[model samples]
Target: EYRLTNPPKPPATVEVMDGENRKHTLQVQVLGAEETWHTPSLLLASVGSSGGKVVFSQIRTLDPTEDVKQYGSTLNRNKICDIAFYQKVHLEVDPGQYESEETKFQALQKSDKARLEILQDLLSSHLGLSVAEKQGPLPAYTPGYFLGRHELKLDFLSALQPRLKADNILKLNLLSLQFCGKGVEPSKPTASLMPVFLHACPQRFSTVEYFENLHSEHIGRLLIFSEVMTSSMEGLDGAVLHHGLAVVACQQISGAGRSGNAWLSPEGCGMFSLQLHIRSDSYLGHHVPFLQHVVSLAVVLAICSQAGHEDVDLHLKWPNDIYVGDCIKVGGLVVKTIVDNTMTVCNIGVGMNLDNNVPTTCINALLRELKLAPLSLEKFLALVFTKLEKLLVTLEKGSSGVDQVRQLYYKYWLHSNCEVTVIGPQGSKQEVTILGIDDFGFLQVLAKDGCAFSVHPDGNSFDMLRGLIAPKVK
Candidate 1:
């Protein structure tokens, strides 16, 4: 090994000459195993011999750590023996070839298979669902199946169903199993059937055909959409079909379509229904509104059924507003009723910002303070619907349905404790401290005089006051 402690002495200066008779001087310093080589304008001299080369020899007997020491020894030996003097000329080479098409294809195939396997695993584990081979031909309408432990229902369908065909089956389509019961209340189990259709293909389909298929049913037949399926149909006179409820939510895959609208019956007695129109890029904006309406109606019906309250006093507020909280604006509810001598259609709409990040004129600024990521529209909708179904079940049993929903809503209140400015009609304004929402979806505010006032949705003015600095207390 090259020892750093002791080294050899220096050598005298040397002269070198090139083929062109060019002359140069060189210096060599040797400190035992530590040798320093210096060339001061040294010319290249052939000297009828090879230039120089350095080679490394491995020490077979030494351990891994000791091998590093051996390397130094080899380097020292080469220096003292002038082994670098026997090197050859240099050469240049080109770059390597690119990856072949077949190789890339195989890699992609492997990656796709891996992803599919992961999906299958997740479905089996969390969703408790299974997949089987297709029994028959295309457009197959498989009976609904129950999800394990969760009691959720799902239906399988080929791309050939009327709705799927009308919508065009550019991908795999699955029908959701929904429940339909007597009247607009989803209390009792009617009949378990598949009504709503879900497309899992790579291509998008038409929304008009989807809604038309949902509205069409044979006489005395009940329609159940995905996740909203019922279990029984006894005592159902098919009149509910005409005067019942319907919710239609559509998201555009392409083309121009970016707005959403919903309608409700005049009172709580008529048919209720919901309708949505989503353009390709604007689905994100309208998704929550559509889902909130559907779920809110479901929850209301569920509550009425359980409480056995034949006289339900409920009315939908426009632009996604719900009525509760001491007559203030606690939440928003919307309903659409289509009634004719022959048929009655009811649709319900509900919308709550839940956890929005964007700032709006009426919405509080607390939403901007939350650092949560934008929620997935599909996943959030599914979860909200599922929870609403459970809450409805509880309410139908004569429990406090409104209280339950209120509690949940309060848990997600962003402006529960804040000072706000309310703009009234004719340029009237008042400052108030929020004391939380009440039972009827209203904004309860404590004025400067310590008195509480309820703010309604349709009043002359209702805007949130913000960006104001508080005065110091003397």
Candidate 2:
């Protein structure tokens, strides 16, 4: 029932309101006479209202296809995706929306008007707005900004330091002090803050600033460095018991990717790893495989929160790639979970192109194309953590939670009813239409002859641009 073949077409009618508060109903119709699975169609209408005649002009808005009517039907799917990308970039400006430079400026001003306010509201509900202040600042260890040692309590640091040192934790200091309520207004709240250790330095964004903006307990410790080896998940095998700990790097010398491909992680990329403790007996633990899906959705929603979703053309490609428009990849997610007795220790790693453009593209570059302001790595991380916290709660709600996430995943993903060339077990190629995810989170595809099969993300390489899904070379 959750699988999708041919999704129902767009609605038949749309209601439009005139300046005088009068409502007019217009019939919606696809532009092209002939429609295919990947056909590009524009829904436009011309109707009269009391104020004036409302004629919906034809514009180059993107649809999920090659526009077979305009271009001949023999184009490949990847070519279609590339064409759609270029068309969307050079879309005709709607006179009503951007008549003049002043009007366009006004529209940009009104965009994301309540984003910060919304973030503050979530912070108040999740982390308390106010709490008792810590007794005093701890001794300054490595001097720069607000000294990292100044935040540590003597008794707690003495104990945690030995354990951290024995574990070979490098370039990180241990702290057991409560989170200082620095950003928000002062108030009296009964709840006291929990104390934990985090990595802070002048090398990147202030560690103190990170916790001040973050409002979730899921990210307990933060470790950020100028560079790291292999991946963020490297040298973290023994840290599973330290739940909610995260490691970040400004640049990765050798970043890992799905199926052992190398991820180009130069400077300006947002790369990090988070360790979480989930109970095996719990609802979320039973669906460990779905963690990748959850993280992927969280990444998309976090960026979408910055500017309105309509302004940005970001979307999820089949398994875990974060694609912009239909061609360029902007970010990705990787999940590694270990079941130790009754505890399922999960490590979620994420790499996003926040401001970097060296590889393919980044989130800010995409925003730039839309004439929007760039997002800071700090703000992006805060939003991502907030979203991940909210989604994890939803995932804990049982079957209904699964259905909600599934619906959202389908909505934000790029491959619905798309036909791709799949290489089977014996290396024979066959074209198949993408249905949806099966119950186990694998991609379910339907063949032309009514034969259905599931494609595992690990075993297959999804080349969306080429419209090819081939077996990964072991």
Candidate 3:
């Protein structure tokens, strides 16, 4: 009966020297079967030596064979040892005797090192930043850097901190510093710096309280203006040039609402705020600026749709809001245009409640209902800029530019066929059938009296329409 036993462990090293002083050492361990067997015999033979001379080692066996005649014999002759078993026992040279295999392995290692260095150089050059290597209990591959030119705003840092920490490969947080040219400046009473910008809201704080709460130490010179202006400040520029910065605020105009803010800089970059508040009880003015703002927003939505593998169904509500479903507001865009004698600069603020759901009336709430992952603020901001840049370039060409924006707006407006109620001046409510938006980006509504009046000629008429308390149906 045949029985299985564990094979002997192979030798660790095998080497051969020159012909005269060649040495061979074999170390092997075998676990034999427990059962007692008949006497076992072992035979050893070597052929094809360097000089073609046969070399044989003495046979060793657990028990001596009684029938052993000569070195060569035919099979079935127990008395004579057969040469067939040992005739062709030629020991071949080790397969790895040549240096080709070692050479290939070394070459592969060198190539891998070179490839990694190239990738690291490319990454550093593309980011225009240097990464500092870190050593600690943290991940070995984490890279860290200090950010220049741009400081992290409070809101941005709050949202980004957690995500960066969660990535096991990122060890250190990015540090941001202000753009101060090389070398420290000398203290001087008259030296002043140009302001960058500021943002504040009056409804959130009164003018006196706002100024008092300004964290003066961090305020720098640039001041942002919001809804705290009155007629008393007319023709008076509130900017104060001090220590390489400018401090400025808005001129509170009469009839302007209590919310919204402005950004001011000495470089002539100014932005105003237009806030839209909609609740279950009220939808205020369908303003002209608001429509233009919504058009800018739609351009962003179009780009996002193209980027995703599946097309997202995105559309706009008349006047100033974006909606994805039955009367649900998903996102909003605020446009503050500062027009001076020289130029008009519009600062567009887009706020999207990516993950939050407002069940009663919000676009974010609808997104949750569809079971889609919330959009990240960083990705959304990047896409918005890309889309805005394209739209602004197109708009610079004149009236033709406006026409293109109008076309895109009309294509995305969801309720163009529904009856829309227009609230005219002084509490007058006019229910008109929706026709379409005109070239000037105005809502062309056909009144019940057979008159077609442009609801928002310059974009301000929507304010009246939005103020009505009840939804007007056809």
Candidate 4:
């Protein structure tokens, strides 16, 4: 059986040629089919340009062979996936079956790999020391605590309330580092120690320098790392830097995506994870799933807040994907939460192609096209935090705050009033119109026959290309 993630529109006309060279034309509207089918059969295909003609040839004879079970299994394997294109493009091959084109493609691949290496080098150089040297004992240069003057750290300790002050926030930072160390690969012992470290930070910093009205404790504590297995795993268990610790990385070797998928993390990608602590009885606690929505809104609003970026057409995909200019994803969010008796520690991981171009387009690439200055990573992050800080306040205000967020989400989302086909676990299908998100962040849709229901983001995968909502196979 063929499952078309992007199926052709209705009124698809098919032309068939008989063995006697006779031809017949038929118009077909494919609605449904068997969920699974197995058979060795000949397949015919065609390629063409958009708004152009495509023709398929007739098969003179039919033959059945043993099923290629290995090929099917390989296709079903769970692995990292990347989006490279929004629409199909046909390639014109030269006489030698594009031998020259193949050679050029190989050269381009090498060039991309080399570019990524250079970016990695730049990230290391940003710290003014090599990874190997930093790992060595008594390294020539080691960042001081909080990368600040000792007196400033003392001042921050005194300013905190007695309870948090006694807890010792600096000690918590050390515990986070130790937690990360245990999770690193045994082969790369230095990876745990050298790359990740505390940088310039203060418990109470002035956001007036960047943006205003943001009163956040942990969000501004920047933890810069050269590389890591994944930012999501850092400071996860144990004493996490919870007021809102920002863990930024140059690159993630194995970044995370929704449903255990892999996120491609190379240099030029703005990869980070924010760890925040909230009360279980708070307004946010009841809507834990909406954290991704909050982050998603913060990203687009952050970018648009800049002077020249006010007109940048950034949008949020359902749940937590960020898209720029027609289905080209530029960023995404993955959230994880651990709940205690009365508090919830949430980790929000974000990966954005701010300057990277591999897999798909980046934000800077779009800026360059618009003749606008590219955004600096530092300022962009500050804006996101500012927007997030403000949005979080709304969540803290109860249902009214959630309604405000939902209203703003609808303003920037791509699926408002969108028509999609929802496929059920039993191979059932229904056409639904997306209304908005519910209180719990699940997609609220109105199906035909005047039925209304919500689709849980975790249970269904939304394929915007073909407007499909299918069960998420674990």
Candidate 5:
């Protein structure tokens, strides 16, 4: 099953090689000590490696999660998920020709180091790499670097302008375009980041540079205003109607959180507001919350691609939040719609903490994942846009399309079946275990007594952290 929110578990024993031909077993305090349902499932495959070859077997690094042990003894302890396909094969190892099942089980310790390398590679390839070439070297941020750069804002295009026309792996041109081959070779480690482009952020219009890097189908235009006086959404929607979207600011300011609270959007935060057009009778209209799902998932994947899959503890907090670990929030989504006659413009606002832009408390920064390479703003945006475009195509397929989108959503859901507080139909708070999400984006939750229920976001505020609250409260 896809247990993206389950933390790494410690193996029962680890095999180590000593100076002389010696082996030792060591116990590592991984994270979650829970069984099946509380964590991800590892599928065992037999590889013919002998017992002596393994080192570092016990503790598995994070594919993702909040240590299950922290919220100890919740409603369903070690609850193995019954949902089909929800559990994915995260790790696979051969039992090493053991005669007994118990011995075979113990044999898992034999392949720790080898398995970790495999896992890290998979994580890096799946999450970190970018599409085209890496943009020019990110320069150090000067104090007023973005204070007044009106010339960088892109011209709004009325329709997509296809840059390339092929369907194959692209080889980026590192010297010129940012999305080219293997991305910019990893930069030497740095202790400080420029003020405007932290996270090794790319300069303003890397999107255009991507076309120069490799060729592909047309895409929506992105007007990248280096810095703006107000929210990008305001800039886009406030103007008479347009055909494309705008990134709030290469660095945003004065942004508002979902609760109407002021969002701390200092320089270096990947704060952008997008204006996407939704059909009058579009699937997005019926599945409004799915937009959040799509946007959050897009951001999550982009982060994984840049931050190294397990680098930062990232989570797709149900509904609309992107969290790191359990308590720290790293990214988010906020959407607003404007009706222009028959056309509907969906305004999306997003924020992610990059490098020093992170909040002191209640937040975690991707930059903290010391071992992983940091992403340039251009690379981060390219990764997200690429994935999002593919997803939107799939989502446009109707019911079947909707199912695909939802399945991907479920695979990365923060706490797919965990306990959360939700308001009952009568408007009082009640705890419910999110069974999963249904067709229309409503959450299927299970109450303590085993009664089944569904929670909608229209009249309710549904969150994995807190079940469901009044709509106004969210």
Candidate 6:
């Protein structure tokens, strides 16, 4: 094994040219607690990382093989499994393969390992320069925590894993490292220590208590946080938020989804629910359905503005979805309204792929691909709040305002004029062309025979001919 200490600055890029002149460039970075290896070459299968050291790693095949079963037993004690638990480090980065975890995971499935010689050369070339760059004393750099393939050792995580697993978050920060820490205190935002979603408010405050002045407003009642729990919304609902509340959570144990489906509570994704009690005669209660559209639009606008581009191709899937570009379901909203006393409580939950956690949906990665810097999570939240306030005011105008909101949403509708195959409950498939969305938000789809029908959110679903549905990573 090659031991190289005191490496140069993080994300040090090095290219290896061997006897055959086969060249490969490796970008080395020191992660907080995630060990990741990525490359485009078939020769270098993978390299291992542990104790803050890079070792010879056997590539992890996406398809479950015999080794997967063995990973839990004898193989767990083997060298491959040993490398599974490593320190903070990143071996390679291909920003081009950026997308949601699901899309990239599909690419991983077809990957084949490189020859041992290629991987060895790739390591020796990069590591040799890493050592050469630092000719001084070694530093006491160590990780506070470590993660194994099947096991993890962390005081705070043990108490939270059960609940996270219950919500189908099998892999926390599966792609990137958001939701990778506890949350920010009622203080300024730190990249690794703060809650990116609501770091700062429109008030310019950078802490939990920062949303204080807004506490006087109907939108800002209480911003609750949990060291371990199910969800931010659930937490608020549990407390019976009478004054209205926006509960933010770093990790969600059990998440709710549409049609009684369980939503995945990922650590890094922005997961929160805003509950506002809209009275029967209130402006918002009369337009509850349109409120969902406004929230979704608000999130899209927030992200688009952050990208410094209004033409980022973000779209609404009617009801509540924020689709980025053409392939990724970046984030979405789940609106559940209830009658509490004589008021209608609108529980508007918003989520998104924020950072490295959801690479595909990560706003930063998307911007990076477009050659732009990422907008800080704190600023992003502040922008969202600002836009949301305006949207709510427009929706409260009754009919005309509602029509304007619909038009805005329609301008970004993802399925309009697209070919889609609707699959009925009986597994029957019929191809149709989406004309547009109805005034009520249901999809207006046209069949080949020229029959137009309104498709509501239900058991029957249509597959858009535009994007591919890759199987999700476990």
Error of 3 at 402 (Å): 3.2
Ranking by TM-score: 4, 2, 5, 6, 3, 1
TM per candidate comes to 0.29, 0.58, 0.37, 0.61, 0.52, 0.50
Off by over 4 Å in 4: 1-218, 222-224, 227-232, 237-239
The true-versus-predicted C-alpha distance at residue 171 of model 2, in Å, is 13
* Winner of 1 and 6 under TM-score: 6
Question: Candidate 3's residue-wise lDDT over 1-474, tens digit each?
Answer: 111122222233334453224564432222111123311122212222331222222223212133223222342443222211112211232333444788755655555544444434433543234544431232111111111113433433344344433221112112111112225332211102111111223242234433332332321112223222221112112211121121122222231211343211111111122222212221112223433544455444534454331335566665555655435545554444444443333333443434444322333343445665544322333344345445544554566876776666766676566776665444466778878766545667788999997665332433233332232221
Highest lDDT: give the candidate number. 2
Per-residue alpha-carbon lDDT of candidate 1 for residues 90-160, written as tens digits (9 for 90 to 100)? 11111112135667556555565444554444345433466342323223222221111111112212212
Residue-wise C-alpha lDDT for candidate 4, range 124-237, written one tens digit per residue: 543232433222222121111232234543454455334342213223322223212224431222323322323334332332343332345446443333333434345343
lDDT of each: 0.32, 0.62, 0.36, 0.61, 0.51, 0.51
Which is the winner by lDDT between candidate 1 and candidate 2?
2
Worst lDDT run of 10 residues, candidate 6, spans: 141-150
lDDT of 4: 0.61
- How many Å off is the CA of 285 in candidate 5? 4.0
Best by TM-score: 4
**447: Cα error in model 2, Å:** 2.5
Name the lDDT value of residue 226 in candidate 4.
Answer: 35
lDDT, model 2: 0.62
- Runs in model 5 with CA error above 4 Å? 1-220, 305-311, 340-342, 360-370, 424-429, 448-452, 458-474
Candidate 6 error regions (>4 Å): 1-205, 208-217, 238-240, 260-267, 282-287, 311-313, 357-359, 370-373, 423-431, 447-451, 466-474
